[model samples]
Target: MTVRVLVVDDSLTMRNLISAALRQDPEIEVVGSAADPIEARAAIKTLNPDVLTLDVEMPNMNGLEFLEKIMRLRPMPVVMVSTLTAAGTDVTLAALEIGAVDAVPKPATATPEAFHDLIGKVKTAARSRVRARSDAPPREAAPQNYSPDPRHVLAIGSSTGGVEALLTVLGGFPANCPATVVTQHMPANFTASFAARLDRVCAPTVTEAVEGAPLEPGHIYIAPGGVAHLETTPGLTPRCHLSVGDPVNGHRPSVDVMFDSVARLKRPMTGVILTGMGKDGARGLLTMREAGARTLGQDEATSVVYGMPKAAFELGAVERQLPLHRLSSAILELCADPAVRSVA
Candidate 1:
């Protein structure tokens, strides 16, 4: 089926560029174009496009405000067009949390590669499952007075729908949670903003993973988005290790590489595969399970895109599959449990 798209941008040039890119995919059709949210509303009512390519900046009501209204009132798949500037990056991240399927960085030059990324994102968004803001599923309550075991490190991997999913999973963390490392598939420019956003909302101290950073309890480290894979070196004091390598499974900060490294460490840990679009983490999570680490996955019902988790579950890598809300408490519980306390 053709993925019908409505291009919404204040700039006529951007609307044309995005339209041109999307049109390259024969399966995608530019159903309509809108210069602002007011016009976009009318188009949505009339054309009823399958997906929306939204601008980060708009006239009258800002893009975020309109997006919020759309998610709350008429939830649909949206791919945001964003600038790579700091403010734009933060705003795009916010858009993801508000339920935009993905974002494409505004390019200085309309190169084939830049448009290629946008086209891919648009098609992916077309197939994604979007929920109204109010239709969020029941979430397990965050645990109270949680005790942490430093022996157990928590490793998580996600993509596609990770921004909102991570916020929910990490929101359940207590002040003294385990030393947690996360690999969320994202653009290189967006990871820093995501880390900062996590730090603001979560109880633990969350930061972007850096070379030689300590893996201590109550601290969470997120893998940077570009060339380095985040892993921990087991030693007198476990320290974060970032290795520059070719992209694994089309991702640099690949979940597979991190999980494999953690597996090689031969330590007790928990591996979680959350909502994502690919199988990057499945094999690595299996390696972790074989190495005596506990493994978990987000169930299909709750996943925005169940690709990675489904693959891992099929491989027998996931010991249990839980919904997004139940994951944080379950992860913490496994870490604190005596059964998973011993080293491999």
Candidate 2:
């Protein structure tokens, strides 16, 4: 099936470049173009495009504000066109949290490599599952006075629909949670902003992993999305190791790389595979399971894209599968001290 797309950008050149690039693919059709949300809103009703390519900054209203309205009233798959700058990444991350399917950096010259990313994002957005804000109930809070086993580390992997899913799961973490590491596929320019966003929302002190950063409780390290793949140095006191290497599983900060590194660690672990678009985390989760780590995967019904978790589940990596709401409780339970009990 062909994916009909509407291009929304204030810049005429950007609109044409995006439309032309998308037109290169046989599976995607450029249905229309709109300069702003007002125009785009009208185009949506008339063109009824399957996918919408939205720009970050527009004339009248901010793209993020418009995106929030779209998700609340008329949830649809949207691909954000963002500039590669500090402010741009911040707004783009906000758009993702507001439920855009994906984001791509705007190009200076419309290079083939750049448009390749855009074309891929358009197709992926076309197939994404977007639910209205009203349809998504609030995620329950983490168990109160949760006590974690300091000897255990929590490793999580996600992509595609990960921003919202991670927020749902990590929002439930207690103040003093397990030493946690995550590898979420994202644009290189966007990771720092995303890490900052996570830090503000989640209870733990979240930061992008740097070389030699020690793995410890009450802290979450997110693999920096770039040339370096994050690894753990082997020892009683493990530290974050940023290994510059070829892309594994077609990603620099590949989930498999992080999981494999943790699998070699002496600490007990619980590996979780959440909503994503591919099989990057499957084999790694399997390795963790083989090493006696409890493995969990987000269930299909709760996943915006079921690819990663489904792959992990089929590979015998996942010991349990639960909906998004229940996943946090399960993780806390698996990582909890057996003797610690909290009253309801």
Candidate 3:
């Protein structure tokens, strides 16, 4: 399928660069360009492109406001192009909260190599089929004692395309769901906002983990930034622990680190590995399976990249593979089952 893209930016130079970059790929076609969000809105109505490449900082309303409007009115796949500055990172993360498909930092040097990478991001965005917010009912608060299963902890690991994936799964969880811990590969300063965003969209109270916070049912803890691992306390009482050690497999807050910790301390845990690139979680997931955990991997058909989950599945770490559309419900059913209950 050919990908039709709409380029949105305030700068004509950027617009041209983005359009040129997409045109390089035979599979992608730049259908339109907009100088600002207002113009982008008009273009969206007319072109109905498959994807949009949006600039974070723009004249007038700014990118975040536009993104919010887009999400509320006409949700679609949008790729954010942000600079490498602190302010840019802030805005980029905000874009993710507004439901952007992905984000790419604008290169410092405007070279051909940089343009190539930008094009790659655009192509990836075009391939995504984002579920519009208007299509589904707003997430509602779940009931108390909604968790059916009382077994081991709920472990979730995600990266790259994780922001959207995590929201979808957590939103389906009950207000009083099982104790859930997540490690999403992200830079420092981003995790707090990410957790806050999840809390808004999910019934469960979500927050970035702090040292020795008791792990309780119905609450979700996100691993703190700059850490490679988050572990649970052994025996009866479980709690959260964060560490800022060397990068494992080239990533801090690595999936492997979290999974290994869960495997060692939270046996029989429900392991969920979502969309990402690279092999961070595969080994740790395998260890989790060996420790008698019920492991689930997102199927390739529904993943943005399918690198992590595919690696884990090939290593026999995954007991079941599910498409993204079905993963949320599957997780709820699995964790909520009475058969999997664990006595403290």
Candidate 4:
């Protein structure tokens, strides 16, 4: 089936360029184009397009605000078009949190390769599930016994829908939670901003991981995108080490790399595979399970994209699979279990 798309941008040139790129794909059909949110709102009602490509900066209303409205009133798949600037990155992240399916950076010049990439992202968005903003209910506080352990480490990996998933998981953590690391597939320019956003919303301190940074309890470290893999060094002090290497599983800061490195450590570790688009972390998560580390994977019903967790589950790597709402409690239970902790 062809995917019907509506392009919304303040610039006429950008709308034309995006329409042209999308038209090149046989599976995509450009249904309409709008210059701003007001026009886009009408077009949405009339056209009822399957996917929307929205510009971050638009007149009449900004993309983030419009996106929030859309998610609240009539949720639909939206892919944000962003510029490669600091401000644009910030807005794009906000768009994702507001239930946009994905984001594509607007190139300075629309090259063939860039246009092709945008087309791919739009197609992916077309198939994504668009939930109402109210679908995410307030999370009940985790039980008192769910507190973190100073000696334990938690490693999480995700891709496509990771930002929201990570926020949901880390939001439940206490100020003195265990040392945690994350590998999420994203552009290099976006990781720091994403971490900063996570820090503001979460109780734990969230920051992008740096070379030789000491892993402290109650702090979360995120792997910088477009850089080397983040790995743990073998030493008395838990330090993060960035290694320059070829991209594994088509990602530089690959989830497999982080999980493998953590498996080598002597401390108690918990491995979690969240919603993502590929099988990058499956093998490494299997290794972690074989090494007696407690492993968890997001269940299909709650995942935005079930690829990574499904892969891990099929491989017998994930010891337990649960919905997103229950994962925080499960993690705490594993952390508190003496049998699980004794495996270190």
TM-score per candidate: 0.96, 0.97, 0.72, 0.93
User: How well does candidate 1 match the true structure in TM-score terms?
Assistant: 0.96
List the lowest-lDDT window of 10 residues for candidate 2: 335-344
Candidate 1, 3-90: lDDT as tens digits: 9999999998888888888888899999999999999999999999999999988889989999999999899999998999999999
Model 3 lDDT at residue 340: 44
Question: For model 3, how does the per-residue alpha-carbon lDDT over 244-279 read when each residue is reduced to its tens digit?
Answer: 688898778788988888887744478999987778
* Model 2 / residue 220 / CA error / Å: 0.3
lDDT per residue (tens digit) for residues 52-127 in model 4: 9999888889888899999999999898889879988888998888788777788877654567677877777776
Number of the candidate with higher lDDT, 1 or 4:
1
Worst 10 residues of 3 by lDDT: 136-145
**Global lDDT scores for all candidate models:** 0.89, 0.89, 0.78, 0.85
lDDT of candidate model 1 versus the reference: 0.89
Model 3's alpha-carbon lDDT is 0.78
The candidate with the higher lDDT, 3 or 4, is 4
